[model samples]
Target: MVKKRIAKILSFRYTMMAAILILLAGGLVLLPKYQESEGIPAEQLLSNIISLERYVSTDQISDKLISQDPSFILIDVRSEERYNSYTLPNAINIPLKKLLDKEFESYLNQDQYDVVFFSDDNFYADQAWAICNRLEYKNLHVLKGGINKWFTTIINPKKPNENMSSKAFELYTTRKAASLFYGVVYPDQTKTKSVIKKAPRKIITVKKKKKMPVEGGC
Candidate 1:
């Protein structure tokens, strides 16, 4: 009888200890972990998103580049291969994958310079912009058309029609000059007729034979 009584007391003690451990674990989960600024407030985050004015035109960027504006910090969000092939002057490459890395957050989470992001198109750059904007980072902007648009406007500019306004002509001339400075090739005004050639067709031979027996003599 005494042995049985001691066994019951030991089992009850273990049960109580288990219950206490479970409660402690739950309490830890309920406690909030800390961070630097606690990020953007919910209400203000919504307001900033709805009121966002986050695009900068290629023409404006070009003007800034020509004037050597120190406030502009162009960010290339494409892969390293693309960035190495071609990128805008004074632009830094921080691939979309690494945008949130600690090494890059200093540049991304600040308002000192006008951060302009660009990719082959607007897609990747827009994504980077969204992340920074969500974090309530200030002075962040996307290159309206990205590098492709830059090529269209500042590189291979088209001449305005004869009836176009002088203002249009003036803009074209500026783009032409910018193209020269950037060492980009302009479309030749002299038209060249394109000759289309057809690829050679391949010949196939068909063979007929008696059906072969199935595997394992099926």
Candidate 2:
């Protein structure tokens, strides 16, 4: 059942991409420039719009978080209120509406980390990706199926049947471990109590201190 639902969500990606490409094609000339470059050409943007490489899977994201990899950034494209209520671990909010703000330029334009955008589903995340892609940002991706997929695949993964392939069970085992890392309490982990899921606390932003330039450096 969960697989079916996720499949349905993924199937909509093409339709959404088409609509977004049309909108982008129509408005490309009107887009405002943040950097000196006027952004990528229409043909390149069209190619990017149709490619599947722009999506990063939930499994990949889970693995990165588990390993504490710092080469990637998760951008929650939802509302500020929604973001304050709940979001994936280490995700920072950059509401879809404010994605292009000058304040966030460093986050979106940098080559330091692979930037990922996500929302409840892929709708808004994909929009964020399209916008950034039009601006020719590198290392940008949309979380495939978004947070809903993350909850379904990582937080509370479904167990595979006995008849399922060994590969399936292996994946299930990995997901189980990932779930534990995220603090999910399974029924078996406690006595006489059902599983309890707790939402992580709201995000707290810590600004990094800038380094001072060397006095003698040219």
Candidate 3:
């Protein structure tokens, strides 16, 4: 009888422990859902919690550059050879390998410039941005689509979008109109022709003056 009683007690203890463990496992699964349901937007919550910065698009940057905004310092994070071959105008060539060096800290720490990083692709820029972010440097941004998008947007501007703002459309139209009037659009042909056609010269004859003697008699 005592043996049976002890057996019953052991079974009851095991059942209780199993129930507690199951409840804990169930809570673990439901906790995330519960937190998500508490009116917090997922992305915003994550962003607020993390130390990382966000990405900025090339078109947006091109617009800012066209507007002559001096808010950001553009950094080309490509290899020396690639950087030399081609890069955005006004961008400093500071390859990714040298990003973390102490010699660069002065330029990186300048509060006036929001350091904008770019490369042929995003990988190099992303690495540089990550390094800066880890170092707790503020006002760092990664150029979305990097140099590839820069060429697409700045060098080869596309048609104005239907959803473009009135100001943006006006700016696009103004640029187009200015290109026609200023001959900047068809530069090679128009500018060359204008340079080739010389205006008629006006030659004026000057009267010869009497030569003056030097003060020190030669």
Candidate 4:
């Protein structure tokens, strides 16, 4: 069945990610004294790494934005230049290089909001997640397929074929509305320029919290 094939693909992806984890661990070892400690055990880190629960789909993110859900935070892991050019509505720019910076620790190392990290593709975002997960950060998720998938699914969704199921059309309708909500301008027969309303970027004030030990084991 289709589901079985999907499961196999995911299995393969995770297997590859496990290998990447070894390389990441080796790379971290060569970093400065600040990153000397391997925060979590290998087994636990691998368990967390291979889990599919770490991803939030584009549709889910779009729904949260449309509904104005305050429970999640979108962190764009691209550079400042790329972030300024284009990013998801309300996404905060936190470059991959500065992810472990003291100033941004509260945002990533907290249990409050569901922090979602994304980049142009999964590469940078997954690296960010791996680094954080090793440090035992909680409630961290990567945007599935990153900004590229978001643009394809939410910004410029293709119309379903006539023979497609009703669910497909319903999804298309939702995506169309979401695209407008995120300020995607579509061509009109009248040819008048449509005013695009941009959402202001959010600022998070980091509150000092007592540091606690991370406890986990496989």
In the range 136-156, model 2's lDDT, one tens digit per residue, is: 788999999998999999998
In angstroms, how far off is 195's CA in candidate 1?
A: 36
Q: For residues 1-218, what per-residue lDDT tens digits would candidate 1 score against the true structure?
A: 99999998997997899999999999988776643455676777677656647878888999899889999799999999999999999899999999989998888887788899999898899889877877778898888888889999998888899999999999999998888778765455223212112222211121212233444367
User: In candidate 3, what residue range of length 10 has the lowest lDDT sum?
Assistant: 201-210
Compared with the true structure, all predictions reach lDDT values of: 0.83, 0.87, 0.71, 0.88
lDDT, model 2, position 176: 91
Worst 10 residues of 1 by lDDT: 199-208
Instruction: Return the TM-score for candidate 4, rounded to 2 decimals.
Output: 0.69
Clash number by candidate, in order? 0, 0, 0, 0
Q: Candidate 3: lDDT over CA atoms?
A: 0.71
Question: Residues 1-218, candidate 3, lDDT per residue (tens digit)?
Answer: 99999998997997899999999999888778755554346665456336444588876676676677888888998988998988776888888888878887877766788888999888888888766765557788889888786655555545589998897787666544433432236556677666656432221222222222443445
Rank by lDDT (best first): 4, 2, 1, 3
Segments in model 4 whose C-alpha atoms lie over 4 Å from true places? 1-37, 188-218
Error of 4 at 75 (Å): 0.5
TM-score of 1: 0.66
Cα-based lDDT at residue 95, candidate 4: 98
